[model samples]
Target: MKFARSLAIGVVSALALSAPAMAQDDASSSGPTTNWTGPYIGGSLGYTWQPNTDREKNERIGFDTNNDGNFGDTVSTIGGANAFSPGFCRGFAKGGSAADGCRGDRDGKVGWAVHAGYDMQMGSLVVGGVIEGGRSLVSNSVSGFSTTPAAYVMTRKLDWNAAARLRAGFAVPTGTLIYATGGVAYGKFENAFNTTNTFNTFTESNRKEHDWGWVAGGGVEQKVSDNFSIGVLYKYTRFNPNDYRVTAGQGTPPSLTNPFVITPSGSTTFARTNDRFVTQDVRVTASFRF
Candidate 1:
């Protein structure tokens, strides 16, 4: 009986110790997945490269040579006549123009952003909403002869952008995620001109306004720690046309010295005005989750 009792006690003790060990083994085999739930806010800095296809499409602004001071003519543009690609000059019905504006090589630039989002985590999927704002280092302008009082100089600039996006990702067992995202985007555009055409040389500028559109992209993100993650993403964005056309005849100061100099003549307005702003962004991202 004593021997039997000792054997039973040893078996019971062995089971008690082994129970914990078995539990541990099961946990290790299953492993822990990265939890991508809740809210997060992060900042990212990256290089952005864009194309100027949209600008090249519509280059002709105006072509009227009839110095009658009437810059109005049949305009061809995306929208209605409110957006003009009209005429300038006097005694001449102008047509045809160059391909692009004076805007220089402004397709690529370095950019940075601040973003925050809330994620809904499922077994293997994550869905979230994020709002972000960043300044794009992309800018370009077109300049040519402004038939104002005298030959004038013109300029335009496109800079900065922002977005609100939705994200959906599939999480792997190793705490890494691959996701796609897209949303509405916003930005600012500005235009200006300087005309010393007449005795009174003057400059005109347009304030940058809100230009809204769409953006889409995808990235691979990995969990670096309990509260931090890192990711690399590629995003593409396209903006609406910010076509700006001006009528010099509307506001022209006649030359006191030369009345026949077509002092009131104007140049063709801008075409699509580089309407399409497309950008490719390669970014490195880091975030902290709460």
Candidate 2:
């Protein structure tokens, strides 16, 4: 009887100790209760206002031919009228200009774009890359004409400022992060010439399309549940201005020899006038934690 009782006691003690040990092992095997950290892909929509500094150009052409004092002024112009219309010199009877103001001045128009990229987290530091693209409208003008006392507007169609960016950030909470980013940028400027009388020439060529700049901002991420999280962020970027040349005579003949003498040595420049931009975006992310 004594032996049986002792055996029974030993069995009960072993089970009691084994129960706690099993529970501890299970908790340890589950690992430290860490949040999800790895590669993530997402998209964001936001408002952006990237402005280039206003630029003006003027030149004097001795129009001894038309002494109304209309010396040739070759100012770079963009959006007033399409320089490609046959009726651009004089407004069209149908009511739309053909000359789309090809080579006069550019109008200062605000524009926007979209973005998508991947992010990774290593402890507190976060790094990633993004691909963003969209369209923009920029303007230029030349008013101080030697003879013609009128302001001309030139509008260039900015196709899109597309680029890839590298990001670095910090994890603030169990499900929150903040970061800064920058990278290489590129885009196309649809170079055309237009005027009030003749919609004569249109030229579409890509030039000096690559640039590098820096972007800085902060954002927050939150976990709504185990598999999904939402985040909101704001960023400011300074983009490099691209420079290229738009040569006319590629379209139709002008009423005169040429509006202005073509410069073989002159350069076309697109400057970032007031390029500080702010972007606000909200994104949804899905994840599986180890």
Give each model's clash number: 20, 49
Instruction: Go through the candidates in order and give the C-alpha RMSD of each one to the true structure.
Output: 16.8, 18.5
lDDT string, candidate 1, 1-290, tens digits: 23323433453454344445544544586532368898999988777765546444334344333434333344222223222222222111221222222324445667889999898889899999899888766655443333221233334455667799998999865566779999999877675654433443232324455678899998777665557777777788878655454443323455333222232343233232234667778777888988
Residue 161 in model 1: lDDT: 72
TM-scores of the candidates in the order shown? 0.65, 0.48
Name the candidate that leads on TM-score: 1
- Model 2 ranges with Cα > 4 A deviation: 1-36, 51-118, 134-152, 197-214, 238-290
Best by lDDT: 1
Q: What is the C-alpha lDDT of each candidate?
A: 0.58, 0.39
The TM-score obtained by model 2 is 0.48
Stretches of model 1 off by over 4 angstroms after superposition? 1-33, 54-58, 63-103, 145-155, 194-206, 249-272
Per-residue lDDT tens digits for candidate 2, residues 1-290, read: 23323433453444344444444544565422224454444444333333233322221111111223222323332332322123122111222332232344333233445565666667778787767666545433221121121212223344556667777778644444456666665645543333232333423244434445555555555443444444544445444333433333422543332332232323222222222222222222233222
